[model samples]
Target: MLQYQTIPVTPFQQNCSLVWCDQTRSAAVIDPGGDLPRILAEVKRLDLKLEQIWLTHAHIDHAGGTAELARQLSLPIIGPHKGDQFWIDGLAQQGKMFGFPHAEVFTPTRWLVDGDTVTIGNSTLQVRHCPGHTPGHVVFYSAEAKRAFVGDVLFAGSIGRTDFPQGDHDALIASIRERLWPMGSDTVFVPGHGPESTFGRERRSNPYVADGV
Candidate 1:
């Protein structure tokens, strides 16, 4: 099984997850936004060797700290697909607009697509390109743990915002219903912000994408 910790980082309180394998002690930090110090501290506290960084999307609040963390640890960054390249390229502008400093842009070592798998130690996460939030958003799902790190995708009682550039509300809904719903209702998901929820609960009560909504 994969062991994980969720660290809410940035002024936005984006959930930065530290997922590792119990057997290997190797880990991957997912979506390090602004609070690099806290993230590094937690890594040390858990005694995990940083292997790589994984991103769900390139939104400023979710990916702002990726560059610095990657540089400091010499770990490769992966995911968010290639379509969100525009957002990655505009990291500086996003920082300026959001008043977040050091939103440096860096290329991903691997651009994920649907049906790809990412490994961390002995555990592996299946990648699903669930765009609409950013046109390239991906959700990391671990079958063994029945947990998903769904950044800015489906929330407890809401869904991701689709007002940003390249965002599609219809696409977002479809991704949630088709890609996420099939993961099984008991699967617990970690959103970019806010508390985690089960896929079943959201399917039943989420106003935006509920079965009866």
Candidate 2:
């Protein structure tokens, strides 16, 4: 079975996730956006082997600690698509602007695209390129867990801000309606910030992208 824990990090309070397969105890940390001590402590407490670092996008709040974490653990980095290369390159500048710790930029070991799958121990997760918030933005979906880690795409009652460089409001909406909605309303999603919400609930109540909107 696959299980995950969310740890909010950085001033942005990005929802960094620690996902692991219980049977094999293999784990991966998704979006280590600072607060490395806290993230590492949790991994230590769980006694799981942390093998990979997965990213959803390259925003400072979502990927601030990626390079450092990967170097420290000798772990491979994956996902977030190649479209986010520029954002990844600007990590240092982003950190300075955001008043975050010095963030180092690094290349992903595997750049993900729609339909790619990532594995952890005996469990596997489907990856989807649901851009808009950022051109390279992606989401991780665990079929068995019925959960989606959707970065800054869609929130509980709101959606991601498309005001940043390369952000596209129309594209975001289309990604939600076309790519995410098909995942089933029952699948709960963990956003980049705030609380988690189900697609069904968001579809019914989200002011921005409700069914009728």
Candidate 3:
């Protein structure tokens, strides 16, 4: 079975998930926003062999601790290929723009693309290129687990802001409806922030998904 734990990090309380296979103890870290100590602690407690660090997107709150943690764990940083290269390169500047403390950037070892498969332990997470929140935003879906790690795309009762430099409201809506909604209403959705929700719940209640009033 695939087991998982979420560690909320940074001032934004971004959800950093540590997912592992019970049989092999091989693990992957998703969205290590910050709180390096806590993430390391969880890895130690779970006795997991960290193999990869996955970022849902390049936003500071989502990818903040990536460089540090990847360096410390000697793990590869993996992300989708569609996000703004400028945003990834200018992480420090992005932080300053948001009044956040300066942070450094880490080049990803692997650039994910749509339909790419990221292997962890005995399972594989399919990459869905669901842009909108950012130019290269994506969600990692595990067919075996029936769960998706949707980063800042669709939140509980609400949705991600589309005012960021490369954000697009129409595109985000299209991505969610076409790519995410098709995952089926029952799929468990692990968002970047806030509580866990199911695709069905959001589909029925999310204002963005609701039919025109």
Candidate 4:
């Protein structure tokens, strides 16, 4: 079975998730935005072997600690998408602008594309290309767990802002209605910030992408 714990990190309160395979006790950190000590402490407390760093996007608030974390653990970095290469490259600038710790840029061990799958131990999650907030944003869906880790893509009552360098409001809406809706309304999502919510609730209540809107 797949199990996860969400840790809020950085001043932005980005939700960094620690997902692991209960059977193997192997783990992966998704979106280590910052505060390495807190993240590492949780990993230690759980007594799980950290295998990799998974990214949903390269935004500073979502990927600020990726480089340092990967280097320290010698773990491979994965996901987000090749489209976010530029964002990854500008980690330093983004950190400075956001008043975050200096973030170093590093190449992903594997750049994900739509339909690709990522694993943490025996658990596998399907990846969906969900660009809107960023040109390369992606979502991780675990069908078995009925859970999705959607970074800055959709929120509890709002949607991702398409005001960044390559943000597209139309594309964001399309990605939500087309790509996300198909995942089923029962699927619970962990957003980049704030509390978790199910697609069913968001579909009915989210002002920006609700069913009628």
Query: lDDT by residue for model 1 over 133-209, one digit each (tens)?
Result: 99999999999999999999888898899999999999999999989998999999999999999999987888888
From the highest lDDT down, the ranking of the candidates is 2, 4, 1, 3
Q: Report the alpha-carbon TM-score of model 1 versus the true structure.
A: 0.98
| Candidate 2 C-alpha lDDT tens digits along 134-194 | 9999999998999999999999999998999999999999999998989999999999999
Give the alpha-carbon lDDT of every model.
Answer: 0.93, 0.95, 0.85, 0.94
Which has the higher lDDT value, candidate number 2 or candidate number 3?
2
Better of 2 and 3 by TM-score: 2
- Candidate number achieving the greatest lDDT relative to the actual structure: 2
Minimum summed lDDT over a 10-residue window in model 1 is located at 204-213
Error of 1 at 21 (Å): 0.3
Error of 3 at 11 (Å): 0.4
Candidate number that wins on lDDT, 1 or 4: 4
**Compared with the true structure, what per-residue lDDT tens digits does model 4 show for residues 108-138?**
9999999999988999999999988999999
Q: Which ten residues in a row have the lowest lDDT in candidate 3?
A: 204-213
Off by over 4 Å in 1: none
Give the local distance difference test score of model 4.
0.94
Error of 2 at 182 (Å): 0.7
**Where does candidate 4 stray beyond 4 Å?**
none
Clashing pairs in 2: none
